[model samples]
Target: MHVQLGVLGPVAAWDARGGVVGLRGPMHRAVLARLVVARRRVVPVTRLVEDLWEEPPADAVSAIRTFVAALRRALEPDRPPRARPRLLVTEGPGYALKAAEDSVDAWRFEHAVRAAGELPPAEAVRRLTEALSWWRGPAYADVPEAPWVRSERSRLIDVECRAVEGRAEAYLSLGASAEAVPALDAYVSEHPWRENAWHLLALALYRSGRQTDALSVVRRARRTLSDQVGIEPGPRLRRLETDLLRQADHLDPGPGGPAAQVWAQATAAYERAVPSDTRTRLESTAGLMRDLAVTGGGGLEAARRHRVAAVAAAEQLGDPEVTARVIGIYDVPAVWTRCDDEEQARWLVAAAERTLRTLPPDGHDAARCRLLATIAVESRGALPTDRPASGGQARALQAAGQAEQLARRLDDTSLLAFALNGVFMQSFQRAGLSPRRDAIGAETIAVAQRGGLVTYEVLGHLVRLQSRCAVSDFAGADRHAAAADRLAERYDLPLVTVFTTWYRALRTAMTQPPADAAAAYRQADAILDGAGMPGLRHGLLPLAELSVRLRHGLVPALDAQDDWGPYESWVRPLLLVEAGDTQAARDALRDIASPPRDLMFEAMWCLVARAATMTGDRDVMRRAATQLRPAAAELAGAQSGLLTFGPVAHHLQGLTAAGW
Candidate 1:
């Protein structure tokens, strides 16, 4: 049977059937509470005796034994005579309470706080909110204020403060600053000594457009810290105050205000009564707004609804151009290594194919080219099982090639740039393709500049940045990153910083210590999450951090048995080596097939090289070195636009030194 204990409020216990255990009198409750606070650790009788009373009677030990017997009878009424207690057991010279952590409200609250620390902001808010709910009143309220009880109560209060501040921080991170204000107001009033709470409250108020109130809060915090703690405000609070005074753009909630207005206008236009052709165009424009909304931290479900409506309207209109526009709405550069939305991609691919069938083969070459390019872009990251006999990559490349050929025949610069982007998306499927991608990026920039396409210009720079990073050309990468940032800022692009921020973090992870690298990755992830680009960084950040730790000879705190998709096959072998299971690591490495010549090939090879080195598998080392030699100048895994495994040169040197 299960047991439930509560210390977040008054000390209490309930059995499996929801009946109170009838802990009688102040002394009885105190004894049960003391055992509960021990958290299943043995507390010696002598310590309990001292904690329970300042003065002891001659029969105090017998009195404690009587209390224990009465508590056991009340807690376990079904136990047979002389049977041992399951929840409370005597161990050595003390008694221990053996309740599960989840059964105790205080323990569960602490667990949630710890778990919230590892999660993204939105999830962290939910976890911390639920944990805070477990506190009904003051902790251990019914117990007498013994020293141990007082200490435990103080610790719980500290944890509660952290949970409150953590929730507010998460809300701020998610741009729900207004929602965080009321709670933080109450929290700061109750716990004025917490500088972080004061900072968050002030920031939340400022973000909610209460600048005067925010300034007052900061000033009040300065006074409170000076008077209460005899110190100045911390660096973060000081910086926040300066930024507030200057009205820094970074202090603004998000850059979504303008995008939100555009979205509203497009949405209104699409819903009006209009001609079929105009309506189709309006629907397509609305679809673009939906994409903007998603990239600007708006809800995903609304974007999906807009997409579906636009696709249906275009198809019903029977206009191939409108259909193509709706199908190719995702105009960003295709840099994702994994398929984010399979259903959406499949739908767009099928729509493009159907529209192509409707157009005459000889004429409408531009429409055909656009449709072919859409197919190429949407066909990215498709699994082999989803392809026909020609294979997914082959099919995508064929479409891209045909589109580029048609664009050149038409002598249209914009169309050619679009077609080249399709080709780049398909061509970037494998490692050692960085040189090819670099050439493509260069041509894209030239063509976009000739046509004055700002969006495409930014994309061109981003592509070059990614390719340069892959090749470990940090100087060249920085140039392209600067170029892209300039264009993105001038054009007011909403989510361009997501890619740039990730690249910066990836570069840091390659060059910095593991802890610093992890922090950089986390900062980048927060930006990505706040931009509503979860699919771009999903599962990749943690793996990136793990790779950094592993490279530094530190064992990562990850479950090796957990499935990591394509990363599982290689990571498992490396994890085995970390576990000191040389034979197991060797066997796992042997079972791994030749690394597929895909985006992850070099990264997987680097992991295999490390495992091989640790296991002294000279044959595997030789194979890994041979496979990784072509990309020796590249950072392994950076080509995937996600993460990196430092440099391929490092792995090659390791392989050579390991007798490869």
Candidate 2:
């Protein structure tokens, strides 16, 4: 008589005729579960007795033997009396279930999962789906609670989750993103802490052209992680959020066509082959370059590796245009406030400069224009300081100006849009320049619209939104924000919504109570955090919270490790005063130099004024008032990109009331 065993759901056996075997009692089933948990290894009679009872009875050893005898009879019903048990054999001092792994459902499921890894995505999906079907409910559901049974059940459940995820991933690899979405959504709902499920669901949503929904899913993931897991989402999920926002083409489903198939095959062949010829090397490098231009194609770190290989190949080819093309692929979005990857930025700048030298000095062609624009953007991050008209900013502005000029002369709309981006980046370095930046933004929007540059157009709207916020034109800012969001959703550009969300939060803070505003900021911060945009909010969130609290005469518990960057010195005195160090706060206020004429000047001065008021430093308060008086109508800190304090008018009123 053939026997089939199962530990996947309940501990049970079926005879070859498909009849359920009736084990004598609960203890019999528990013994079978414990042995199956051991995976055919011997479970000593003494150990079985100890596990089955909290305190074994005097005849516990005999009881275990009796249970095993009943299990053996149920497993092989036709066995003759006094014949040795084939399925459940008694060995020296122990028992082992001598069943083939294929006869046990859990073992067969695990084997199928292992084998699926080596198969094609379609085959893997089929194998895993079948493997997953083996699970009817919790493993060993009918067995008594034993330590070994619990551990094995937990392991089986985890493996079942993996199989579900594996099948979903296989569906995704087969370009069935829409099909993957429902399963992933259900999986994440059941296992909310599974970051990979969230990542795949967001990707599937984005690929299905639900860009806004994809971003919402990411935000939900962030909140779920923070609330339930007490940790941020991992880098892969964050990277996926970033990629979704940018509408990276690679995140879209793979194309279908004869030409696309041929190209895919070529790329695969190039990846597999050694670069023995220049053509092969060029093809390989070009493929890598394309991957480097976006996230989600093995992520930013992998793309950086691709950049290295592409640059080497381009340099070897010794073609200035090719070299410039390889070096100037800046589709990866950068933080405008600071350099995230200084080494890579510097390499780009150096490579562009070298490529420019190879071209004729007097040439005013597209390649030269593009190379200069590349230097302009990369130099902002590559340079050591943020000082204007010198160092990085100066070089960046000069190159951008040249690029813009050449682009106009050539009448290349796309080139003009590209050059204007550089112009906007460098020009945004200083405060009181929002008017100029606004004009640049307008011109970019016009140029981009004419050239059908959807991404640049969205960028222009964001630029305008920031400028409007800086100038305290909330009405205008609202219009720009709406426009940007509309374009973002329409074009599947999710990243644009991140900035607009921050602007909305800031706008909310301007009108709502502090707590309400704080909640909005937290929401925005969650979205920013989900997108892995730490640079944009470095010290901004905490500073905003502190400023709002101080405005309401509330003291904040500040952390010293918060990276306030250049604003640290200006904001330190306020923190000190709040901590009851009035004398130290006054001293710190006295030591501060005139506010740097950068984007945060008015905001930083307001912080100084607030601190001065708290410490009764009339002189410092008067100095801040005199400087901020001209911009009394503007919002403090709004010009600082992703953060804002309240109105300068309000701060100035406080300074006056404090007798400054």
Candidate 3:
């Protein structure tokens, strides 16, 4: 597809046939121009808003979203309603534009100029001329006088200046002294203190048989340098003056002169031979890492090793596109999960964000990676049982929404499903069992199926199962659980199978025989063995549910390990209380931190209170009642249909009424 966006002249988009694309309106054009100037790096929403609005509107975000949507349609007229966009995309809290480096005139110009530096004089002159021809009048000529546009305009002008100087050098190298003279003269007139421009001008004049003119040019440079910055001309200029004075035939172009420098660079490039199997080895490394992620116990560690090697290979090859792909591995989150604490999680998130910032703005890998990183960061706050709703969680949801919009434009259903998973997880955390959750689950399932992503398909079904279970729809939950089980087995995803088995156990625990539920829990444990709990969230629910229902002996017997730190810690007390070991249960609960108004703390305190009452521990009972009362009140007010509600609140109420 020969898609070209012209910001060098008017802000215009064109197809291969040279037909103009309707950017919709002036506002839309401005937005496209702004994104193009960013050269594929993400532009934050706040920056865009500032550019699009002088005073800023109350509904700035809605208006920008509308403008970007229209611009997207204009850019890709043939795209279906939700097709992945090729030109423009949302990244994090902002938007980015994507096109071939040669398709955008400014990028084409910069690349050409850079390439010209290593070429012979004739080729360099031709390339520079072609690059300069891309400019019409000014950079983003049609855009209004916004700060972003002006800033980019200044940068482009500097690039233009560099191109002009390069062109002069190429002309001088080719013995076109007359042509070089005028070009350098014009350039120096505009950028008076550019020492290279003056030096080139002097060299051109001297070569044109005007030694006196060349000497005068050096004098002018000395004055300009002294006046502007209170410094004399540097070593190059001083050396040039000495050569001109001697009128030496051995001008020699000096050390590191343009012609000599170009030849040296070309020589170095030729000598820097890469290993024959470098690309193959990099691919092998990435493939092995991916293999370990799926089949080996190393999980994300293998993936991380692959990322480092892949990125190194890409950097060696000087391919940003390859670097992005290497970093965008779906297993990126596995690293975040392995973080031992929230601080570590936050550090990982910050690092991921930095990496995402460096990725090409609208790159598929970058967009997918941003979504994954956002989801990982947000996961810290959206754990099913966390209290006080993490401050970063809302920001994560917003980022996921942006990623979803971009994924749809890119026509990437897997990324769309992953992004939607983040949205659903956030919504579940906030509202629990709402119609929104049902709708999100259904939509994600459809996306996964359409995308033919079995992993996501399993995840989508699991979400539906969770939502159904939240509403106590055991039959519906069972159906979804069965679907998940079949998909997990078919896909050979042991983790998915474990989740499904755990869900089945939770469903049967409250309704069926204890033995049947214990068997199901045991199946999940056998699948998990002792590995893959990177954090509190991964295996918490299954362990908590099993410990809550079964006796202490049964809890340990279900797993291979007798010492399951946090997992055993949370459930062991409940088992002790149930087994009538009240003192032991009380001792077990002592280390469990009961933060005020926390749901987990309240739930645990209810059990502690009940055990205290049975053991005639009045002091412990009074403290538990005091802690449970406010926590229960808070939970009642913020009751989500997501988890088992009323148990803690009912315990607190029962205790209060009994005058404990």
lDDT of each: 0.77, 0.75, 0.62
Q: Candidate 3's C-alpha lDDT? A: 0.62
Point out where model 3 deviates above 4 Å.
Answer: 1-292, 296-322, 331-348, 360-395, 409-411, 428-436, 530-564, 567-660
TM-score computed on alpha carbons, candidate 3: 0.43
Return the TM-score for each candidate structure: 0.58, 0.58, 0.43
lDDT of 1 by residue, 448-554 (tens): 99988777787788888878878778789889888888887887775777788877887787788988989998888777553444456555666777877866878
Alpha carbon deviation, residue 215, candidate 1 (Å): 29
- Estimate, for each residue in 1-660, the C-alpha lDDT of model 3 and write its tens digit: 467888887888888899988887788888888888788888888888887888988998888899999987777788888767766776678888766566887887777676667555665677788888888887788788977788888888888888888888778766677788876888787788789999989988988889999999999999987887688999999999999999977554532477665865664574465444566446545655655454322343335455555656655675545544554444321211123345544644554455566666664554454435455433543333234444665556566677667767767776677667656645533322334666767887898789787766766676666656544566887787788778767766555655565665565555556576557556655555323344424544454444435322243333222334433544566567666677888787664544222223444455556556555556666777765554443332112211232345666765666567
Compose the digit string of candidate 2's lDDT tens values, residues 168-239. 877777667788888788888888888888988898888777999999999999999899889999999889
Q: Best by TM-score, which number?
A: 1
lDDT of 3 at 100: 57
Off by over 4 Å in 1: 1-294, 299-305, 316-322, 383-390, 560-566, 582-599, 612-626, 640-642, 650-660
